[model samples]
Target: MAVTLRPEIAALPPYRQGRAADAAAFKLSSNENPRPTHPAILAAIAESHLNRYPEGAATALRTRLAERAGVSIDEVHVGAGSSSILYQLVQAAAGPGDEVVYAWRSFEAYPLMVTVAGATSVQVPNLPGGHHDLDAMAAAITDRTRVVVVCTPNNPTSTSVTAAQFSAFMAKVPATVLVILDEAYYEFDVDPQRVDGLTEIANYPNLVVLRTFSKAFGLAGLRVGWVVGASYILDAARSAAIPLAVTEPAQRSALTALDIETELLAGVDELIERRARVFAGLTAAGWTVPEPHGNFVWFAAGDQTSAVAEVLEEDGIIGRVFAGEGIRISIGEEGSVDPLLGSAARVVQTLPKAGENARLG
Candidate 1:
């Protein structure tokens, strides 16, 4: 007989990753940085000692990050990825009979992680403009709620929450509940008005800000991420984490990436410029693209999502497709711009109801 598994986990679908593209196509499905790993990061990785296990606390990296973030070392927690830390936080704080609230279609992993921790997920639908309805989210929180996630420049949508909006939302939330701000694409955000968690973190006793080295630093393969929050709250996440899961190479790379942030950030500036061009191109072509603040753009293709994705694929422009909802195309290599624009134009011209369907306006 088959061994029994928890009913929730048994019934849940496994996580689906973005589709990989062939040689001739642009892999814009994962929102990965198109540039190669910086030379300094590679050199740092080469210097790692493989014979021994990594530092469980990632002390050196944490020290560097704490110094930069203006937080105490004890207040910082590093994990294999931001997603890993997210899981640790959920498992640490929520369980059966507890509810974890977040915006729907924000991060695909939110629901999965909550279920694995034996917590119920309460997903608030995104506003029509593809932004979070912070007021709605605040109202969704009940006494049963333990954790609430706020993903700025939310994944698959690329829309952000303003600092004022977040401040107002926070005012409505109880200090007893934990708020996790997942800023996976923080580096790409150029909005001066957006919430800077590092600057605002000091005000909240129950808030934890999650950031990743994956998108900006080109460390997706290494899987290093960190959190800044109350020491006690982070201690709980640490308790839930697997020991030494963060490898030596990852720590070294993150440290080196920090050291050479200026150089890496220059590449980010270029991606921002590319994003502007793509946004303008799609708008000119009569598609209503949201103002993307992340390293990707969203097309709210609705029922035409699959058809639009097919058009993009045929043009060798592969994007992350959410059938019946939308498509998210990452800002990829410089050469991908024209092909993506061309494909988007084709979708608008060929499909009826394209204007109404291409945006959740």
Candidate 2:
């Protein structure tokens, strides 16, 4: 007989990573930084001693981040990735019968993490234009709600919540509920009006901000991320984290990445420019894309998702597809721009409804 598993766990599908591309294709499926890894980070990684376990606490990195964010050392916690911290936070705050609320189609990992922690997921539907309806999310919270996640420049959709919207939402939320602001793509957002989690974290005692080195720092392979919040809440997350999951190489690399951040952020500026071009190109092609604040664009193809994905793949552009939902194409190398736009234009012409559904309500 098969080993018995919790029915919910048994029924859940394993997480699917972005499709790998062949030599000719641009891998825009995972919103990775297209730039080459910086020499400094590589040198730092090379210096790691494999025989020793990583410093379990990642104290040095935490200290640096705390100083940078103007928080106490205990206020910051590091994990394998922001995703890992997310799972830890979920497990720390919620359990069976409790609810973890977030906007639908925000981060694919949110529901999975909630389920793994035995908590119910409360997904608030996004408003038209792929943005979170913060008011609705606030209203969804009940006495059973333990945590609420807000993903800015939300993954896949590439839309953001403004400062005013967030401030208003926070006002409506109860002080007892935990609010996690997932800002994994923070560096790519150029909007002056976008909510800056670090700047806002101090105001809310229950708020925690998550960020990662994966996107703008060109450190996706390193798998290091951090959070800034009240020491007690972060202490709970720490209690839930797997021991020594942050490797020495990852920690050292992140420290080096921080050292040369100015140089790294210059690359982020280029990606921002490329994002603008891709957004403009898609719009010109008659696909109504949400104004992208992340380093990617969303094609809300709805039922045409698979067909549009096929066309993109035929043109050597591999993007993440959510079957009937939509396709999320990351802004990649400069060379990918023309081919991506060409494929998008073809989809608009051949699949008229795809273009129509791409528009927000």
Count of clashes, each model: 0, 0
> Stretches of candidate 1 above 4 Å error?
none
The per-residue C-alpha lDDT of model 1 at residue 33 equals: 92
The candidate that wins on lDDT is 2
Instruction: State candidate 1's TM-score.
Output: 0.98
* Total backbone clashes of candidate 2, pairs 3 or more residues apart or in separate chains: 0
Instruction: Give one digit per residue, the lDDT tens place, for model 2 in 77-189.
Output: 99998999999999999999999999998889888899999999999999888999999999999999999999999998999989999999999999999999999999988
RMSD of each: 0.9, 0.8
lDDT of 2 at 344: 93
Between which residue pairs do clashes occur in model 1? none
Residue range 194-243, candidate 1, lDDT tens digits: 99899889988888999999998899999999999999999999999999
